[model samples]
Target: MRGTGLAGPGHRRGATPHRRTISILTLVGVCLLALSATQTASGEPAADTVDTGFAIPFAGAPGYERLAPTQVTGPDQLNQPLGQQAADEIAGQVGLNRADALSEEQYRDLVAGGGVGGSREAAEVIDACARILTNTNGRPLYSHVDGHPTPSVLASYGLYVNTSGLLESPANADAPTRQVNSLIAPGGFVGTWLRNNGATHTLIALYRSAYTVQAVYGFAAQQISGAAQLVTNTREGVSSEVGMSMAPPLWIVNFALLYILNPSLAAAMPAHWAPIPSAVADAIRSSATGQVPFSDYAPYFQ
Candidate 1:
């Protein structure tokens, strides 16, 4: 018989086969557990399982056709220009002719007091506010004026129709020029309109007053609530999110090539590298249909 020693053939002292086997099994079990956590019970990838590291299905451009001023319907006319419709609506609200001009005192009083009564001046103020809040085509108007002007600051100025037949600032007039303060002032016409109209709650926020002809013209750009509807209902559509990380700089060139050469490959590319197709499909569909599919989804896009 061979001598029983540490190096004996039948009893190798350092060889622990059972321990090695257990260690290997434990590692395999951990890997399987991790894989299971990332997958569904049926072994399918979960809808949100693909954590690409950043938000996938990025928001593309608006899906609907942004209707021009003449395409949208007005309260008074079937399809009136946005400016004319706004003026008409303001006139109706305040009991004034659309073409009527506001006197210096009336304009001043309206801005200072807000649209309290159904006076022509109050109507003008309301109209001006509406224009500032929305554009002629009935979209939310976002302005980039330098500073936010107060109602008092606005009331200190006067509005006049210059020789160019447009509402302009007077060069040397007895009265000062006026401007719109914001979408809603305390006890002002805009605040009143916002309170009365339930639909305009989700529209754009107010901006500063620039007190320029272009700024004044922006008021006539669109109807406040109607444009809001167009934006909230029609323009913006359903959106989805995914997780992905930012791509390397070189990915841009690859993405372009993949997009041009192999659309499916581009679609399959990492969200950080390329835009997901499903995210932009609605926009493409809308471009073809010429109308936004607002009814297809919920009220807000998310």
Candidate 2:
């Protein structure tokens, strides 16, 4: 595999020892900080509307096919929380919720061993990523301040505000900016997107475990889902009251769309992190859904 690790301004995730036995809930808590996702079309909060200037150009670019997926006719604000809204929008034959979420049951006859490997293999990558995600753009990934809009305590159980440049605005809105509106758009960040998209696969090099490629990739894929799901769910759940959304929200309808729409995400993924099972990639590239163009992400297939 092409061995260039995550490329960006900073690239040194402390290699954490493999975590052999992390409960799903514990793993969720550990990874909740370093993740992010796009926002759903419906009920997109006034604060999170994407800047069309940057997003429009991206939509016109080679890969993006349509802003709204085939299933969504248009923006219809629904009561469902952000995470569930995104999941529902991307389900059916049109999406890969099971694959992206790393549901082992979905593996069927596709992979050898659930494709995720043992617990230690997955934990090493998770710990490495968590160390890098402790904070982004200088703001704590998890807000310790508590109160409305901004909190005064570690409020909301553990569901705190995500001020990272990934989902929220960067610390310096006036700084020289890139056309990354697609990455941070339709989120609280209206001006700029500057957070680091942690590439979990890069850790393979640090750990020197080329053999664990599949496990690393599987964990990374789950991280993408977790990052987006947790960030979207927790951030959108913020209210006058201090509490967590038992159910998080979602940004994009399909998880695959986020990779295409946000080049920054592509930059952060594994060099060889392809469709976990050939089927998912085929579906995304087949032109069947008519949501995104395979041309937009041709390199991924190759």
Candidate 2 residues lying further than 4 Å off, grouped into runs, are 1-57, 60-80, 83-86, 91-101, 104-142, 146-254, 257-302
lDDT of 1 by residue, 1-302 (tens): 00000000121367476764454345435533553454322212223332222111111001100110111122333211224444333222222231223334434444455333434554453343323212112222232222322111110011122222222111111111122332222455544543344312211111110111112111221111110101111123443221111111112222222222123222332221112223222342234321222223212222
Per-residue error (Å), model 1, residue 171:
18
Model 2's alpha-carbon lDDT is 0.22
The global C-alpha lDDT for each of the candidates, from Candidate 1 onward, is 0.23, 0.22
Report RMSD (Å) for each prediction in the order shown. Answer: 29.4, 21.8
lDDT of 2 by residue, 92-182 (tens): 2122222232223322211221222323433333222222211222223332223224311111111222332112111111111111222
